[model samples]
Structure formats: C-alpha cells, structure tokens
Target chain A: MTIGSQVKQSLANMKAIHATLQQLALTSTNEEAQRAFHEAMLETEQMIAALKGRISTLEREEPQYKGM
Target chain B: MPAWLEVAIRSICILIGLFIITKLLGKKQLSKLSFFEYIVGITIGDIAGTMSMDLDIRLTEGVTSILIWALFPVAISHISLRSKKFRDFVEGNSTVFIKNGKILEDNLKKEKYTADELLEQLRKKDVFRVADVEFATLEANGDLSILLKRDKQPLTIGDIKPYVPEEKEPQTVIMDGKILDEPLATARLNRGWLKQQLDQMGVAIENVFLAQVDSYGQLTVDLYDDRIQLPEPQQKQLLLASMKKAEADFELFSLQTNDAEAKQMYEQQAKHMQQLIQKLQPFLM
Candidate 1:
C-alpha cells in the first residue's frame, strides 16, 4: 500500500526470481543455458542490492515509512 | 519421319504442353479440385492421350482443345475471386451435416453422404463418438470439419491462465552427416559451438544422421547407428523441478517464520514463484 511496502514487495519478487535463476544455473545440463542463468542471477543480485540501498535512503528521508 | 518417331515426338510435345499448362494453372490443381476442375483435368488427359497415339488428330487441334480447357478454368477462377456469388456457384457451398449435436439427415441426403461415409470422415478426424460433435460441415474442398461439444473439447493454453513463452521454430543444424551453415546461423550458433557440443556428447559430426537446435538451445541428435542411445535432454525438467522446490521452501519458510513482516514476505514470494512456474510450465513441460 505504502511506497515502502511496494518496494519491499518488489524486493521479495526480485529475490524469488534470483533464487529461481540460481537454481536453474546449478541444475541446467546445457552449457549455454547454465551460463545464461548464472549471468541473470548475478544481474538480479546487483539489482536487489541497489534496491536495498534505495530502501535505506528512503528510511532515512521518511522515518515514518521505515519499519512499516 | 518414321511412324514410331512421329509418335515419340508427339508424346514429348504433349508432355511439355501439359507441364506448361499445369504450371500456368498454379497450385489449385494440386490441392482439392472442384468438380469442374476435375472434369477439365480428365478431358485434358484424354485429349493428350489421344493426340499422342492417334495420328488422325493433328497435334495443333489437341493443343488448342487442351489450351481452351485450361484457360476457361483460369478465367472462371479469376471471375470467381471477384464475385462471391460466382465463387459459391463454382466451388459449391459447404453443406452442414450436423448441428447442435444432432445429425441433419435432410442435409446429408442433399449432399448424398451416407451415414457410414459420415462416420468414416469423423473417424479420420479421431472423433469416435457422434454425440461428442456439436457441429459438422462438409467444406467445398470435400473436407469434413467438425467441432466437438463444449464439454468434450480438449484443454488448450487459453483454458489455463498461464503465461506461456513463445517458442521459435527449431533449426535443423545437421543432416546426413553434413553441418548446414545457414541453419546454424539462423539458430544463432556457430560451427565452433556445434563442434564443441558434438565433442562433449562424444559424437562425431560424420556419425550424426540429423541434429536440431530447439528454442531452449538444447541440441538433439539422431545418429547413423540406431544401436547407440543418447541421453534425453532434461534441462527444462530439471529447471522446473528446482523452481517448484524453491517455491515449496518459501511456503515452508512462511509457515515457520515468527515475524509478521517476514511471514508476509515469504508468502508473497511463494505466490510469485508459483506464478513464474505457471508461466514456464508450457515450455518446460
């Protein structure tokens, strides 16, 4: 509902996608598919880290939105 | 010219004429032919046969007759294209044989289609039960098109609301021990990649009978020697299973977590993961 909650929801989805991609990377027999999934997982991890930073900045700017 | 030589020349001439006429007529004759087109075809063949053997009829006369027969059909088709009424008249209207799960005996009699014939056509379509058919029609091309009852219809992608990834046509990268460069390029792969894959599989290029690269980038090979077996590709299945397991783990985490926020996040993530699995199911399965 709130911007913080929205961000948290997005973060959750990103984490799930990342986990799925990591699983695929580990389990895939095809070399190209494995490499692709691994790369996508790394990219998603960076995005998750970036989103976490955004959430921290939001928390500092709007204290009411923090821990909500 | 000798008598035998004359007949040989005539036959060759008729054969060439038939080829040219058929080419000019286009692919319409290759598909279902209308009754008129069928009659014209038989007449042309008869004329060609007579002209080839019977020296009494001049070759020019036979050619003229065949040309008239071919031209009239072409002209009729061109006219039929411009006029819906004329097209219906020329091709004949598609007759309905069944409606609302009921066989129309009057329509069947009009089309002179016997019950056995109708049953045979339905069987060819793999529909054994006439009760399952909601509507059936005899197309102008003589094809029996049938629609099964709503409850009898097979499940399709639309029935299940899942996001299905579009699949590209697979490329035949190898055939008869020869690597096709064009198809490999179409598949966005190179000879080096193919060689490496073949090497990994312990299969030589020369020993491969056929090989295809699917949308998932999985290469499947049929070997010249049928005795040897290659392991089936299971990357899709493995990926799907892993995703399912991850989804189950998230659900379990949601159940076990004490913090309300963490529990909510896990539940939402599990739901999202389930959606992703649904999206990928069509391709993976």
Candidate 2:
C-alpha cells in the first residue's frame, strides 16, 4: 500500500476506536473506568488528527514517487 | 492396386498437399511458436507421413485432414490478434511476482514457481538481493523483466553530474560509396549539400565507404582508402547537442512540477530549447 493509503486506513481505525471508547465512558458506572475510557478516547482522537496531517502531506507528495 | 505404384502416387500427392498447406499457414519461426501451434505443426507433419506410407487412406482424405489441422492454427492466430482477452487466455498474461521490493508469494505459487526459481531468475538479472528489485514480472513468454530500485540502478552521467549528452540514433547515409536516399531525406540534406561537403575535402562521394549522420547534424565519414584525414569537431555540433539535452531536461521538468507558475516556466524553457535546436541545425558539422 502507498503511504497515503496506509495513513488513511490508520485514520479510519482511530476513528472507530475513539467511537467505541466514547460509548464505554458514557455507560460505565465506576469513576476510574470512566476516566480510563475517556483518556483512551482522547489519545485516539489525537492519533486520528496526526494521521490526517500525514495523509494530506503524503497525498501532496504522491506524484513525485511516480515512475520510480 | 500395385504396392509400388500406390506408394509413389501417395508420396507425390502428400508432398504437394503439405507444401500448399504450409504456404497458406504463413511463415513463423519455430522458436517463437506457442505450444499449441507447435503441436499443430508436428501433428500435420505426422499425418502427412502416415498418409504417404499408408495405402488404405485415400489421397483426398489425407489432404483434407492436414488442411483442417493447418486452418485451426491460422484462424486462432488471426483471432488472437483481434481479441486481447482471448490472446491472454491462449498465451498467458504477464504476472507481477515482485513489486516495490516485496515478493508476492501467492502469485509465485499460482505460477507454480518456487522461491528458489524466483531467486534464480533474479540472479540471471544480476540481482542477488530481493530488496534491490522495484518491480519484477514474468512475461508472457516466461522471460523475466526486472526493474531495480532507484538506488540500486546503474548511475548515468546525469545522476553524478548535471550533464546529459544528446543520445540520438545514428542514421546511415551512405553505404558502399552509394548514397541512401531515405536517410538523406531524414537528415534533411540535399544531394547538392553532400556534393559540396565532398568537394570541399578534395574527395569524391564515390570514394566514401560509409557515412552516418546524427541528430546534431554531425557527419561521420569513412573513405575506401586511408589517405584522407577527417575534419575536427566543430562548436556548432556541441551547441546542438547541449540544446537537445536541454530540451529533454525541460520536458522532464515540466512533467514533474505541480506548481502552475513552475510548469509554465518549464514549458517556455522547453519551447526555447526547441527553437535553439532549429536555429543551430543549418550550421552544424
């Protein structure tokens, strides 16, 4: 896979993980478990943002790799 | 029927029949023939031999059988040229076994090739490391076409320095002291210009053994005798070569640029290079 495609896939997976963690945090009764799930959601969101940046950069640079 | 009489008549008839069939089938080298075509050729020959030696089979029947065998292959060849999917089914499409230094194990397995066999093919291309290959494909004829990674490819002058010589195909203008009309037309020079060049050297055109012209309009001549020395290289030819290289570089630059302003500049540069080449053509060599 190209770097762009890989970064796009990572962004998709991070989004899915963040959705699951958000659901877990909302339903959990224990304070510690809720806090852990919220923290996981925050990390996943950050990773998704980083991957979006990488995907944009890679998409811009993709043409330079042609004919190589 | 008399045995000797039957044998002689059958032999002559079969010979004529096979000769006519072969002529209609057209010419193709045995090495280039596909497996089905090869089988068809051999089976036709075998049927002809059988018909010639056997007394039971009628001459007309044997000829008809051979014709049927010949027609299938010729028809298939014609159809294969027109239909790409049929041609791929018949002769097999080229398969990519390696891409971006990664070996596709499923493709290798599907082609019934082992890892060792793939390595052997790589070795034939002088590539010992699998990591050095950017793309390696098995061609339709089972030949391997390998493209190495950019870092592993042989370095050209353009890679080391900023120089790219004009690489034009040498066109033969004269052979055996005879001027070739086609190349003269291709080089865009008249017979009068050639005569003037020969007259300036105190030589006749008939005395020249071989002559070639390059893209830079440089004429390389060889005389039948060893008495006459060739002229030295001129500045105009070098200038033309540089202009040709510049034109090619500008074309490549235009393809690589994404910026609109840079692309316009590159296109303009390429146009100027082409103009320089046109301007320098008359004075070269």
Candidate 3:
C-alpha cells in the first residue's frame, strides 16, 4: 500500500483503538485491563506518528501522486 | 550492577508491585480514588522511592511494610469482588439522584452533591433542562450517569422501523496476514466462507490490511494498496470533534461529590487522561 494509504489506515486503527480504550477506561472492571488498554492506545499513537512521517516523506517525493 | 542499574532494577520491581496492588484494588480505585487511597499511594510510593535510593535503609524493610499494609485493601477487594454487599461496602453503590423525573434530595445529601454540581453534570450531558432527566444516578466510579426521559431519547432502529434481525454478518477472516483463530469459533464463522468472500473481493489474505466481521457479521474489508488518502481537512476535523465529544460525555457521566471520592476519581482520571493525552501528543506533533 502507498504510504498515504498506510497513514490513513493507521490513523483509523488508532481512532478505533482510542475509542475502545475509552470504553475500557469506563467499563473495564479490572485495573489491569484498563492499563492494557492504555498501553495499546500508546502503541497506536506511536504507529500513527511513524505512518505520518512516511506519508510526509512520500508526499515530498511522489510526482504523479498530487493527492498530497 | 552499577549504582544506576541497581536503582533502575529497584524502580522496576517497585513499579511491578505497585501495579499488582493497584490491579487488586478494582475499578473505583483507579477511577474513583478516595483520600484514603491517596494516602496509601503516597505512602507506598514514598517507601518505594526511599528504598530505591537510600543507602542507609534496606529495601526489604520498605517493601515489607508496603506489602503488609497492602493486605488490607487487597482483602477488602477480594471480598468485594466475590460478594455484592461487600462490594457496596468497599466501593459504595451508585445513589439515585433523580428517579422517575424527581430529585432524591436525601440521596443528594448522602452523596454530598450540591444542586450546582448536579446542574453542572447535567449541562455536561447536554441536558439543559433538569426535567429532561428520567433517572440520574451517581455511579460507583463517581460519574453522574443520567438516563434521559424516554420520549427525549432518540428512537432506536426497532422503534423507528420494525424489522426482525437479519442474517449474521461475515467476519474479518484475515488481518495483516494473520488468521484470527479465536474469532472464528467465537463468531461461529469458518475459513472457507471467509476465503471465498476474499476471493470475490480479489484480496489476497496477505494483502488484507484489516478484515474484521463487524457486530452485524458483515465483513468490513480494508485493503493495503498503493493509494493516496491522508485524512482530508474535513475528516480530520470530524475525528477530533468526536473525540472531544466523547471526553465531554465522560466528564459528565463521571462526577463525584464526596470529597474523598472526588479526589480519588479525579486523580485516577487525570493520571489516565494524562497518559492518554501524552501518548496522543506525538501524533499531534
């Protein structure tokens, strides 16, 4: 997939994961589950950053893909 | 080990122990901490901090004290987990503030919530009119979860248009080239059907970025391709808007009036939210 597409998918996944973490924050009965959700949410943010970086790099290089 | 490494090891051990103790404490401990919990948190952290750094005092003594004190909350949590009444004792039950469109002044008094706090919570919930609430309760996590009047609530699918449940939706058989073995049986869907569905979509299992059968059992397919699509300005705005809305809703639902409960819940949510915001900050960068 293109870096742009990868960034989009990663962003979407991060959003979903954040939503789930919110739910877990309020609904999870166990403290560890809440911690896990929080950790996963962090990992998602990192992935988003990495993907966005890739997208920006591609936007700078790709000539035909004016979709930047 | 070097001095710094020794300190690091001590810090990690202390952290793990704290984590276990925190986990045993339950949802309210993280979400609705009282003054008592704060004392415990401080005391444990203090001891851990001292243990990791102090050369004169030994680590065992500090850890033992922390563990000994931990047993009280731990035992209470265990009992609460097994028995509903004990749960009520340890975490307290949600008090009905407004039941059947009427305010329960006694409960409000018991929960130490002022009329102003109630109004604030309602405003956060987007309920400007107090009469709009059918039931409002102070949930265990110190949230003012309000159930609005039935007439005021948005109509559900069944209410708007009557129809029986349709066929179950297909599941995402492949995600990032990994077969979800657990979801297959849990969802009562198998590989052959999923493969056929992918075949129709011309999505190779390896190329499938994320495929999950949604709740409706519909296969929601996301493919990996050399395509361009950064969240346009509008989509980005929408994404942020929704996240903000969710946070506002949570603030409304999770309100604690009791000073002890208020402090605890605030700290818990603050710590949790701080971590979350910090994590998301990188993406914002």
Candidate 4:
C-alpha cells in the first residue's frame, strides 16, 4: 500500500478505536475494562504518530511514491 | 460609642484575622509543622496582636502583614512540589527509634525529643513497657509509630491458638427489610430455611435494617423495630468525645474576660479529653 493511503487507513483505525474507547469508558462499569480501553487508545495514538511520520517522509522525498 | 465599638470590632476582627492567617498558613494537613511554618505562624500572631492594639494601624496594613507572613509557606509548598532537594531539607526522613526494643538515642536526639517524651508518647499508645516494643519509628511529622512485640499485641485469628467454626447457622437471608435472594442462592440456603429461622426468632424480614453473614455462616441481623444492643464500647466513647464540648463552650464564652489561666486550663483539658477519645478510636471502629 502507498504511504499516504496507509497513513489514511491508520488515521481511520485510530479514530474508530478512539470513538469506541469513549463509549467503553462510559458503558463499562468495571474499572479494569475502562483502563484497558484507555491503554488501547494510547497504543493506537502511538501507531498513528509513527504512521504519520512515514507519510511525511514520503511527501518530502520527490516522487519516491511511484516505483518502490 | 461608635468609635469604641469600631475599636472593639477591630480587636475581634484582628483575632479572626490572626486565626485565618494561621489556618491559611496550613498546618492542619501535616502531623508536624516545619521550622518555616512555625516561624510564619508565630510572626503572623505577633503582627496581628500588635496591629489590633495600635489605633494608627489600618486594615490594609493588617492585610499586607498577613499576606507577607503567608507568602513564604505558599512559596515553599510550590517549590517542594517541584523540587526533591528542598522537600527533603524541609521535612527530614523518618528515623528508627527502636529496633527490637533497643532504644536508638541518636534518632531521638535528631528529632529533638527527650527519652522521657518518647516514653510518654509510647505510654499514650498503651505500650508503656518498652520491652514489649518490636519496632518504633519517629515519623517525619514528629509522630511516634510503634510495632509491638508479638505477645504484647492482640492475637488475630491466625495466631498460635485456633478456633474451628462449630456450625453453619442460617446465612443473611434479608437486608434493609428486603429478602436477599442472591446471597441465599449463593449460600445454597432456601426460602424455607429463611422462613424457619425467622419463625424461630419470632421476627419478620420487613423489620430488619441490616443483615450480614458471619465467618461461620451465621446470619447477624439488625432490625429497625429491635432495641439493638450497642455494646458499651461505642456508648462509652461517644459519651467521652462529647463531654468536653460543654466545657469548650464555657471556655469560649469566658473568652470575654480574656483570662490567660482560664484559656490555658480549658485548652489543656480539651486536649486531654480529645486524646481519650482518640485512644478509644479502635473500640469505636
């Protein structure tokens, strides 16, 4: 997959997870489940950061998107 | 008369101001007051006293004095939050006072407390006999914390002696005037079991306020209709904690005369009475 497309997919996944986390935080009465969701959100955030860095690198380099 | 009244008002206001400033300087949270806090408290008290009596001193002057006295501790607290070095220097670490009943004089000296004072504090903890102590610590806040020797301490269920449960009595089948189906189901006891227990006791579930299953599976129930047996410990402690309030009111009322002896006597007695309530705390719990 192209770097830009991959980044877009990651962002989309992070948003979905973030939304689910908010819902889980409210609905889950168990403290452990809520904490797990929060930790999941943090991990997704880190992944998004890493994916964005790669996309920026792709954009910076001239037309490297095409061949490899 | 208005001028005399204003003067009287200012005097009272000064006392309030001093109290506020000292309280705001924040000693209540900590068991020990630091040197800086102690100094700030004393200085504010002195300034409030002087400013109240001096007719020339304005309210603004008192405010500024209180504010100035207050700033040091606030600043110190802020720094202590961010700086570990400053925190350690301000409130020294806890020191071991006794290790297996061996008195550590050096720690006592560091705490600036005499041996007699340590013994007095221990006695207050009902550990008058030092040999009975296993570990004693001079906590950073100037409080003495003790770990007593094994035999001197109250034996818990896991001690040398063991008592086996005799029988499983009817578990708590109802609480707050409602039948507890879940607990009954979990305990494998049924409605018939509950009905029989209630029938034997000649009381209905609707009258119960609280119910619990003890370790031996016996149901302990408290009823709103029942004249509950509140054992002597609770009654005695409540009685003691409240007795001094009347004395406190008398002392507060006699503040009009401003007699130093009366004030000191009242304060001392109130403290003594409070300590008694504090000692009775375990029983209350």
Worst 10 residues of 4 chain A by lDDT: A24-33
| Cα RMSD for candidates in order | 9.0, 25.6, 24.6, 31.2
Q: Largest TM-score belongs to which candidate?
A: 1
Off by over 4 Å in 2: A1-68, B1-33, B38-70, B156-168, B226-285
* Reference-based lDDT, residue B29, model 2: 24
Q: List the residue pairs that clash in candidate 1.
A: none
Candidate 4 lDDT tens digits, B116-218: 9999999999887999999999876667899998778997644743432222334566777888888777665567766776676667778778765532223
The lDDT per prediction is 0.80, 0.70, 0.62, 0.61
Better of 1 and 4 by lDDT: 1
Residues A1-68 of candidate 2: C-alpha lDDT, one tens digit per residue: 55445435545545654675565455333445456557656754654564465455556678664322
Window of ten residues with lowest summed lDDT in model 1 chain B? B161-170
Over B38-157, each residue of candidate 3 has an lDDT whose tens digit, in order, gives: 566677778777887875667878878988767777776678669998766766677899998999999999888999999998999899999999999988667789899988997775
True contacts kept of each: 0.00, 0.00, 0.00, 0.00
- For model 4, the stretches where C-alpha displacement exceeds 4 angstroms are A1-68, B8-32, B35-39, B109-114, B157-285
lDDT of 1 by residue, B1-285 (tens): 898999999999889989999998889977746877888888888988999999989877888888899899999989988999999888999999999999999999998999999999999999999999999999987899999999999998777855545556788999999999998887777898899889989999999999998866678999999999899877667667766765676677567646577578667767766776665566567
Clash count in backbone of candidate 4: 0
Query: Which candidate number would show the highest lDDT if scored against the true structure?
Result: 1
- Alpha carbon deviation, residue B81, candidate 1 (Å): 2.8
| Interface C-alpha root-mean-square deviation, candidates in order | 8.3, 33.2, 15.5, 25.4
**1 or 3, which is superior by lDDT?**
1
